[model samples]
Target: MTSSLLFASEGFGLNLNVFETNIINLAVVIFGLYKFLPNFLGGMLERRRSAILSDLKDAEDRLDEASTALSQAKEELSSAEQKATKIRNDGKTRAEAIRLETEKRTVEEMARIKQGAASDLNAEASRVTAQLRREAARLAIEKALATLPAKLDERAQTNFLNQSIKNMSKD
Candidate 1:
């Protein structure tokens, strides 16, 4: 090619063939970028996409496990509550039975104590009546001895003695 075709005249300086130079520079830059950048950038983007997908799968698995655990915990809590309720009811029934038994025993004891007291009172009354009868008999014998006369004739003494014996026997 002629030098004039390769170099063009310009007001500022000698201008190289502008269209050809621009085309060659663009081609070289495009080839160099394509040669190195596809491996580096492509591999980085692929790794990033793979990591994101794995993270998504792991999150889904964790969510499913959490749901299962929650359901199991709820079932266990329900069972525990049922057991607690049963225990409370059993305790109430046992307490009621014990109360009834205690009341029955108390009533029986009270009746027994009252009967014993009545027996004691009856025995005391009989003892007092016997003592009073004995005291009255002793008083009658003393009165008879004090009132008898000592000076008398044989026939008079015999009659007086017979009357005194009769009075003593009557008492």
Candidate 2:
């Protein structure tokens, strides 16, 4: 009974052969995991890195495009502002020119009107003077005819007729 208890190989005894076999199996599994898992996990990690780098590059390109578009918009805005200023200046210039031309035309028209009025006044004065002279000559002729018959007697009329006939023959 004492020998059976001390040499219990099939129960709780420290069997070196089984222990060595377990150790060998664990070492083989650890070696297999170490050999194959790094390659598989490394391939997955490399693909993930490449995807991240591609996303970063695409973001940078988009940023550059946005910056270029913003610059172009700024330039176009400046150009439009300049054009508006030029248009405003041109409008002012044209308005000034038109105003000056209108003023000149107004002055010329006033001058022409004044000249026409003066000429009309002078013509009216000349017509009135001529009419007055003709009226005075007619009145003088009438007065002389009314007094000539009473002043000249038959002998004086004969002498006047004889003198008028002598003057006509000398011409």
Candidate 3:
């Protein structure tokens, strides 16, 4: 390695210190990077990290808001379902009431019609009975007159009228 590293002296260089030269080059590069690169790159990295963190915070806040909104929507949906059930029950109740009322009305109307028909029938029967009675009384009076006239003189007529008066008084 020593022989490989040794070189023939050129015209102006007989002595060479490679280790010191390498160390000096390394120092210069290190100092140059330290002086300029840390300030610029570190500042850029910090700014980038801050922007990323801010975006993450905003996203987290948006996620929370969205979850809250979703919860509220679910609650509203549940309430709406309950309201729909109540409305359905109310409608059923109203329909039942209407049916009952209609049935009651139908029954009342039937009763009224039956009563009116019965009244009409009774009136018609009473009128027929009265007419038959009047006809029967007229026939009886004619038969009595036809049978009584063969023996009826004025004296007999007077005696018959007196007997009729006496029977009526006894009754």
Candidate 4:
């Protein structure tokens, strides 16, 4: 081993006097890195894990809030739909009632008009019949007054009077 170390030292043209010191310096630097690096890296990794957990908790809370709001919105939407349906049904019922009332009024008005027309017709027919009777009686009276003096002479009037007296005695 001493011969190989001499040959290695001779190959690199380095003297054996500094080799042990260089190895000792390298060993010190390696030991220092091994001792401090794990603590620093472990502290950084732990901080990162805590930050990730906090972010996950915040995300979960937001999700819960969103779910609750969605449920409330759904309930409101259903209530609005039900109210709209009820309003529509009420409007239809009111319209139908109005239609029925209008029809009834129209029928009553028609009946009243028909009754008035019939009454007017009956009154006009009665007036016409009365006028005709009065005209016929006037014509009959005029004809009799104009011809009675010429047709009934003294002998005819005496014979008619004697026959009227005989008819009165029989009754």
TM-score-superior candidate, 1 or 4: 1
Show model 3 residue runs off by greater than 4 Å.
1-34, 142-148, 158-171
**Local accuracy of candidate 4 as per-residue lDDT tens digits, 21-115:** 48778888999889997799889999999999999999999999999999999999999999999999999999999999999999999999999
Clashing pairs in 2: none
Q: Please identify which of the two predictions, 1 or 2, would achieve the higher lDDT against the true structure.
A: 2
Could you tell me the C-alpha RMSD of candidate 3 in Å? 6.7
lDDT of 4: 0.90
lDDT of 1 by residue, 41-111 (tens): 99999999999999999999999999999999999999999999999999999999999999999999999
Q: 49-136 in candidate 3: lDDT tens per residue?
A: 9999999999999999999999999999999999999999999999999999999999999999999999999999999999999999
Which regions of candidate 2 deviate over 4 angstroms?
1-51, 154-171
TM-score of each: 0.61, 0.62, 0.64, 0.59
Top candidate on TM-score is: 3
- Model 1: CA > 4 A from native: 1-21, 136-171
Error of 4 at 97 (Å): 1.4
lDDT of 2: 0.91
What is candidate 1's TM-score against the reference?
Answer: 0.61
| RMSD of each predicted structure | 7.2, 7.2, 6.7, 7.7
Using lDDT as the yardstick, the better of models 2 and 4 is: 2
User: What order do candidates take by lDDT, descending?
Assistant: 2, 3, 4, 1
